[model samples]
Every structure is written in C-alpha cells, then in structure tokens.
Target: MLQSLQSVAFAEISLAGDLISANRGFYVLLQLAPDSVVDHVGPYINNPSFTELAAGAQRAMPGQVVYQGLITFLGELGEPRSLLARVCRQGDHLAMIAEHDVRENENLLAAVMDLNEELAEQQRALARANRQLAAEKAEQQRLLQELATAQAHLVQSAQLVSLGQLAAGVAHEINNPISFVRANVATLGGYVGDLLAIIDAYAAGEALLAQDPSLLARIHRLRERCDLDFVRGDAVAVVAESAAGIARVARIVSDLKNFARINESEWQVADLHACLESTLNVASHELRGSAEVVRQYGPLPALHCCPGQLNQVFMNLLLNAIQSLEGAGNGPGRIFLRTGRQDDQGWIEIEDNGRGIGPERLPRIFEPFYTTRAIGAGTGLGLSSAWGIINAHGGRIEVRTEVGKGSTFRIWLPLSRTTSE
Candidate 1:
C-alpha cells in the first residue's frame, strides 16, 4: 500500500494544524508514533531556517499553498519532530497548510523555490504599469512596507517613491519571469509527501509487522482490546484532502487580475460582501473539516472602495477568526460574520465564539504581531490589515471581546453607494 505513494497520488496531512501526523492509510500511522511531534501540539519544531523559508514561500506562492515553515513537536512520548508546513492563501496570510515529503537532494528544493522569482516578476511588471498609470503606486508599496514596521519617510517634496530608490526598470525586467512562474505555483502546492505518507506508513508498518509474528499477534490482541473487530477490513486507507485545485484555477486567475488592478491604483468601489464571499470561497476547502464558519450578513450596499484591499481586509479578519478558534482548542467553536446598516453608518462585524481576548491585550489588537496565539501560529496582521482597510474607507473598527466568551469586531463604514456614485 505504501508503495503506491512513491509513484503518484495526493494525500492530506495534519502536520500543520491539528496533529503532528495525519495519513489516510490507518490509525497505525498516527499510532506508529511520531518520535518528536506532540500529540496535542501538532508539528512545531524549533528551527529558524524553517520559519524563514516558509515565510519566503508564503510570500511567493499565491493560490494553493501557504508556507508555515519548519515546525517542531514533541511526540506522545518524549521526542521532537520537525515538519515543513504551509496554508492556502489566495490573498495574504494562510488558511490551510501541510508538510510535504522531504526531498533527499537539496537541489530539488532550490529548483522548486523558483516560484518566488516568478512572484517578484509579477510585482515588477505591476510596478512598471503603475508608474505609467498612477504616479503613487510606488509610494503605495513603500507605505505598505512602512505599515509593517517603524520605517517611514518624512517627505517634504511632492514626489512619492519607495525608500530603496531602486532601479525600477531593472526590477521590472527581473520580475516579469517571477510573475510568470508564480502563476503555476498552485499546481505544485499538492502535499505529495503527505499523500505518500499514509500508504508509506501502512507499508512501513506492514513490513515491520511482517518481520515478527509477535507484532501481528500484538495487533490482534489490541484489536480485541480496542474493539477493532473489523478495523482493517480494507487493506488500504486513503487520506481525505480537498483544495480548490482545478476549481481554484478560475479564482486564481480572478485574484491575480484583481491584484494587478488594485495594485495599479488606490481608487475602486467593491462589494464588501462579495470580496468577503470570495475570500471565504478561496479558503472554503481549507477550513471545512477543521472549523465550521457561520455567516450572518445583513443588507449591504455597494462600497466605493478598493476591492483587492477590501479582500485583504476580509482575509485578515477571517484568518484571525480561524486562528482564534484554533488556539482555543479543537472543539465546536463558531465564527460569525454580521453586516447591517445604521442610518449614516454601515458595519461588517466578525465574531468568534472561541477563545476570547483579554482587556489588557485588547488595546493592542491592531499592533503588529500582537497575538495571544502561540508564536508561530500567528503574525498578528490580520486584524491590523482589516483596521487599515476599514479606516481607509472612511470607517471605524472596534473590538468587543471577553477573556472566556469570545471576540467580536465591528467595522463601521460610511455607505458610499448612495453618496459617491
């Protein structure tokens, strides 16, 4: 059975979110016992390279994969395990992730990393196009960088540009190929190693169980002990995996195009609900099994705002909601989204009935990396980006959360549908 994974077949993995290991092959794979990964903690390894590489990968990959880097986990017993992980991110941040099969050859990893070069190329082309259309795009990118850090430019002159003062044409030329390559990254996001793992585990265990009759006898003994009369009815078990995959292609095309459009200028009107719906759809297959999302959107009007940027806002909020539930525990937690109107005020609220935030930490919810979640589990930009978008649209964002109850975010926007148009 494990022999099948070596050739070709896709499998799902739990190395990133819930457990250190997940293979469709059988419970034995989970029981084969991960040496280092913790049963409750999942795969969280202590390694700097893993984090940087995963971050770089997430920055590069667009549709299917979201790199979470190397994770270390302590097994059921005293053992440490490491795994490369990623999430599915069509916008910014990750929704789903997995650790892939490790390649023996380092060169293969380097070759695959070419996708980043492609993303860079896309940004480059977008920049050149921006230079021609909107004079402020360069500054916009720079300002975005500043938004993440303490870096800022006190400009006395009217001209706007990046802090690097980089050679724009050269950047463009280099980025062209990058954009070309990134377009295909989703195709490669398949967790081939994960798919191979279950079969691999079954085969690995079957082989070991073959060497000694005691192991087989022990299995039979445990089968009765655990009430596993027909446990191994089928010789092989396949992991259940669902990604946007082929259906995701169209959405990918739409996002890339929208990214290009939004990146071109800061002015555009978008349906806030539509953007949220798209982000939810893009992240749908990723969140289906692990968490359940409940949305309650009230009547909303078309917003004269940047759809791409708004999509980013929706992405951040939803991701934060998911992470909150994840951090709370693997139980039945609910995430709710509410939208409605209040005369001159219209709001979109995202509420999570998961782990709630404290009053002390509540003040800094929008601060960069200000998270209650474990270190690697969060970047803390989701709410902040949501804040930035809602603010830019002439809106207000506030959080109402309790330490144990849950967290709720209310984003107020001026209904420009009637005013702007």
Candidate 2:
C-alpha cells in the first residue's frame, strides 16, 4: 500500500500534525527534500486547519477517504499555489493526494482583480466630482453677494434721480408767484408811508379849518370814527412783516433750485457750505419737528465736484441723524453741522445727540441692504450709496459713536478733481 501511495502524488501526516512521509511527486510540487519532510508540513501548507487534518488522519479506517476538497498552500518560492486535494486512511496513517488546478484558478483570479480595479476607479471619480462641486458652490455664493450690492445701488440711484426732478419742478413752478408777492409787499410799504403823510397834512390844516367850523367838525367826527392814528401805525408794521416773510420764501426756493442742479451730470466748482445750507433747507421739515440744527460754518476752499451728488450725500446723512433722534424719544434732539478745511481738503461733520450705534453693529453700516430698522421702514442703501459717491470723488467718511450717547459722521472731500478722471 505504501508503494502504491508513493507511486501516486501523496503525503502522510501523524496525529500530532507532523509530516511523516511524502511521495516523489509531492516533494517535487512543494520543492521539499525527502529527508527533511518529517515535522515540516506547516511550512508547506497555508491553511490553519493542520490539527484537525491530523485528527481526521487518525480516526479514518483503511481505504476510507477522510477529506476531499480544493486547498491552497505555499510553494518553495512562498507564492500561493492551489490544488485539488484528497486525504485517505491507510492503516495508522493518512495520505493526502493532490494535483495543481492552474487553469481554473487563473480565470477566477482575473475576474476578481478586474472587479477590484473597477471599484477603486469609481471611488476616485466620486472624490473628483465632490471637489468640483465645492468650487462651484463657492463661486455661486460670491456672485450672489455681488448681485445684491448692485441691486441696492440701482434702487438708491433711482430714488435720488426722482428727488432731483421733483425739486427742480417745485422750484420752477413757485419762482414766479414768490417773485410777484415779494415785489408787491415792497411796493405796499411805500404806499402806506405816502398815505400816512397825507393824513398828517390834513391834521396840520386844523387851524385853517376854523374859517369853516362846520367843515372842521365833520373832519373831527370822521377821524374819531375811523381811528386814523392806529391805522397809520398798523399798516406800516403789517407791510414790513409781509415783506420779511416773502423774503424767507424766496430764499427757500433758491436753495431748492441749487439742490436740484445735480441733474447736470457734470462736475463744477462747488461751495461745500452752500451745499450744506441747501440740503438743510430741503430737510427742514424733517428736522423742525424732531431736533434743533446748529450750523458752525468755517472758511473752506471751493471743490471741483459733482454738487448734486454731494447734496444727495448730505441729505442721506441729515436724514439718518434726524431719524436717530426720532427713535430715541428722550426729548428734543440736537444736530450739529460743522465745516472746515485742513491740508487743502474740505470736511463736513454731522453730529447728533441721539441713540448711538452698538459696537458690534457699527462696522456693517455701509454694507448694501444692511439696516437696523424694521423691514418695511428702511431700504438700507443710504450709507452704501453715500460711501460709493464719496469714493468716486476721491474722498472718505469716518464715524464715531458711543452707545446711549450719540454719533458723529465726518466726511472729507478732495479739494480738486483727479486729473486722470
């Protein structure tokens, strides 16, 4: 039986998991020495079932097959090798018979390797796609922010243009009536003086009237009935007051005309103080009910700028100051307007004693569409547009405030237009 097992390809192991013997074919397959085969089965077999294989070898009867299956093992080069293997009992020993199944194994390994490569490629593609999507998301966010700013600018510019047109119309329509009324009051003042002189002459002729006592009595009765002394004094005073009032109206209309010149769309030599005065007149209604405005004028050089745009900036600033006071409700508010020149630059300051901005919110005031007011009450583009206009004019605006105290906005403009522009 041993000779027959040796003729076939076979190996024998003891119950203690030691290699007892092996045929010439088995030795050739595993590249093992026949003399060193004993107790060396672990070096050649790759599976962790050697102890169970040894036990099966001891329990099987003669000529009975103990196990039959495909198995893997390590060859002389330490590379994986597969075989069709079987174990059978022969007396007290078990013989393992095996043959290489190379063709079937090669086909199975190629299919598994192709599937793994495909899975790796899929994961790499997914990673690249994720990176691209992240970049696109970032770009979209930037574009959205830019669009919001542009929209706010457009709306603010439209509002300023409309206001300019309205002011121009008002100034034009009221100019004629205001002129005539002013002139009539001036003429009436002279006429009242002449009539009072005539009444005086009649009084001086009282002595001559003694020649006709009846005529003198008639004149005395008429003077007593009409109260001529009071009429003469009151008529002069009334004409003077009317003239002063008309003068004030004319001044207001003139300011309106100046404020509306922003529609010219060209730069001109501008008086900053004059612009401030005009803006104050235009904003008088808002200020009168809420605060007292104090003007501190200074000698400032003329600026080469777009007067209308500067007037718009002044309007926004004044409105903001007035509204701040209106919200405080701590009694009447105070607004201070100061103008000065330093280092050939002109500066105007609009300071208010009202509710001040909190520190956290102060930084974002100039951002487009950012407002602290209720949603429908404010459009939030005033400061943003103001800042843009100032920047284009080569100027800057500075702000200082303390919570519960007040706020001050200072604007400095270039004395001359940039030659490049």
Cα RMSD, model 2: 16.9
The C-alpha RMSD of each candidate to the native structure, in angstroms, is 40.5, 16.9
Local distance difference test scores for all models: 0.54, 0.79
- Candidate 1 displacement at residue 243 in angstroms: 15
**How many angstroms is residue 175 displaced in model 1 relative to the true structure, after the best TM-score fit?**
18
Which segments of model 2 are wrong by more than 4 Å?
1-137, 201-227, 327-332, 419-421
Model 2 clash pairs are: none
Candidate 2 lDDT, tens digit per residue, 1-421? 4223332346767655566776676766676655553455766775636666667767765556677676566778787666777766655666676755544334433443454456557767988999999999999999999999889878877877888899899999999999888888888888888888988988898899989999999988998899887887789889988988888888899999999876566878888888999889888889886899998988888888889989999999999998888667657799999999898788999999889999999999999989999989998888998998898788999999987778999999878676333
Clashes in predicted model 1 = 29
